[model samples]
Target: MVRFSYEGSSERNLKMIITFDLVNTSNSDGRTSLQDESRSGRPNTANNDWNTARVDELIKVDRRVKRKEISLKLDILKTNIYESVYDKLGYRKVSARWVPKMSDEHKRQRVEISQILLHRCQQEGDETVE
Candidate 1:
């Protein structure tokens, strides 16, 4: 029973020491420390480079592959597959299809094409257009 004096220790540090002591005594395992113990099982396997690459390859093979299908095929979670596709590979859903997120260049091209079509339509007049 160590005596913690207010003159020697700050309130916060004393509280922390007492909390640590309580935790150490209450711990079922003999190893009572602040460090994280080595965990078993699959870890963050789905978020690794290998899994990201695998998900990317699957998307390349089939743009319309559902997250559920990818999870089943890769033996990973649907949320993980979605994160890999959207966060890692930069893809998004458009019209029920997975497509690469549009870049500035692609957006400009789309706008240009639309403007050209509009100009042509005006020249021909609404009645002549169709």
Candidate 2:
């Protein structure tokens, strides 16, 4: 079996040619650890086991602490937190700002700004500020 892997500036593609010996069989002699292969291909262990307390702690840190701070405290890579944790938990290592909080503040600010703009427009006849 031959496998060719090509890497480009932006992407990678793989091509494989299976030989007869590489084919799978129902017999135990042909079996291999699929999990091992998958795990080998997966990203390294960084944030696999997380408890509730740890998650909460991470969230707290994400709220106020910087990535460097969190990495220093947790002894993990900032990239791991940003890639794995943020993707899975929807919270960065720092600034785990909640959507609800932002939504409320954004709505309030928009309303206030619109009111101000409308008032200014009414007074000055300029609609561009809104």
Candidate 3:
């Protein structure tokens, strides 16, 4: 049909045909509908606000806490712990150290410090002074 004319690979077209056939058969048999049915399984509860807050607090207390340690302490999977720390809390690791993503204030401070050091070096007129 014109609706199926959208460019797609043969594999995709085959899958669409199979899905259509399955849906048609199910409808004819009155077994199911096209709508998604509720799945049964343990829902993802590790990356919630409570866990995020807990993880943030732990990070604040010790920025170098490992993901494995957090997973053990919080009873969450390592992947979930990583997601909470990085994606949700906006943290990244540097030099084997966990730190929050730098904001504008941090950038400004870094630039200010470097400029001050550079000016001091220029005034000293000695490049190799320790």
Tell me the spans in candidate 2 whose CA falls farther than 4 Å from its real position. 1-43, 51-55, 92-130
lDDT value, residue 99 of candidate 1: 91
lDDT by residue (3-120, candidate 1, tens digit) is: 4534336655554233135565547567657687799887787799999999999888998889999999999999898889998889998887789998899999999999998988
Cα-based lDDT for every prediction: 0.82, 0.57, 0.82
**Candidate 3 minimal-lDDT segment of 10 residues:** 1-10
Steric clash pairs (candidate 3): none
- Each model's TM-score, in the order given? 0.56, 0.35, 0.56
Error at 57, model 1, angstroms = 1.6
Model 1 residue pairs with clashes: none
Off by over 4 Å in 1: 1-43, 126-130
Q: Which stretches of candidate 3 lie over 4 Å from their true place?
A: 1-43, 127-130
Return the lDDT, model 2, position 98.
28
Worst 10 residues of 1 by lDDT: 13-22
TM-score of 3: 0.56
- For candidate 2, write residues 1-130 as lDDT tens digits: 3455554455354444344434454234555543433344666667665632354476564566565666666777888666544555555322445221235777899999999988888887855654
Query: Model 2, residue 91: displacement in angstroms?
Result: 2.3
